[model samples]
Target: MDKIISNKEKSYLAVTLSGDNDKEVIKQMASALEEEGYVKDTFADAIVKRESIYPTGLPVGEINVAIPHTDPEHVNNAAVCLGILDKPVTFNVMGMEGETTEVSLLFMLSIKHKEDQMGMLQKLISLCQDQNTLKEILAKDQDKINEVMTALVEK
Candidate 1:
């Protein structure tokens, strides 16, 4: 499989955020992504709408995670923006109506190509499923997180 995340892209991984809710967190992350030139300004609203309609929350063992993404039109470049929230935020679980999950980690995908989405998503799911990897991601510094994530994508 092709490498899903690049070293330059890994620099976009953020360690923490102060958002109190999903919308707030997404907005903040999207804005940061825009500033980094990874996404267009419209990405924030597009992702929020996508999340509301098709939530990305996944229950991965002890920690809940969310992968929020939108159509390729809103992307300036391809990169994964990782955000670890200070507190868990509620998000509706994928494929489950009316049920929600408390999410602490957010993976905001800015992909310029539509075809690469599924492959990258599958890798992300794999990463989430590994407890050891998740622990490393949650506890590591930005550089270490980038190293771990880069290694995962290259595998």
Candidate 2:
């Protein structure tokens, strides 16, 4: 994991059953942010490119999690956006998960320091054990997903 941003500080949480590839999913999240004026069109394309060759999917030993991201030069502001998938989205893994896994969440990170998020990333990985919390967020509709995301900030 490069570095994971605070789930609380993360503003956008989109519950999407996106396309198969990591780059495709990155495009989905990045396009939404771009439409929201958080990033440029070329920036989104750059993000997809960064994620294409250098995979950001983290293997949990059993399954995988997609951490699609790019250089801060692609983003207009410092923020984090998430895309949760109930149906698995196939993305490449960095570890020995062999091939790939059905990713449940897309923790699309937009950060300043590409690697300084080590501590926060560690914290996020630790929090992954909270299955109930994860389930609640994953099971939400679009409106409820926003609420759940906003609640993280309140806490």
Provide the lowest-lDDT 10-residue window in model 1.
Answer: 1-10
- Tens-digit lDDT track of model 2 for 34-95: 76566667777887777667666765633346777677777775555667654667776655
The estimated TM-scores of all candidates read: 0.88, 0.71
lDDT of candidate 1 at residue 50, scale 0 to 100: 96
RMSD of 2: 5.8
Count of residue pairs whose backbone atoms collide, per candidate = 0, 0
TM-score of 2: 0.71
lDDT of each: 0.78, 0.60
Candidate 1, residues 25-89, lDDT tens digits: the string is 89988887887788888999999999999999998877789999999999987877777777788
Q: Best by TM-score, which number?
A: 1
Model 1 stretches astray by more than 4 angstroms? 1-11, 152-155
Candidate 2, pairs of clashing residues: none
Per-prediction CA RMSD (Å)? 4.8, 5.8
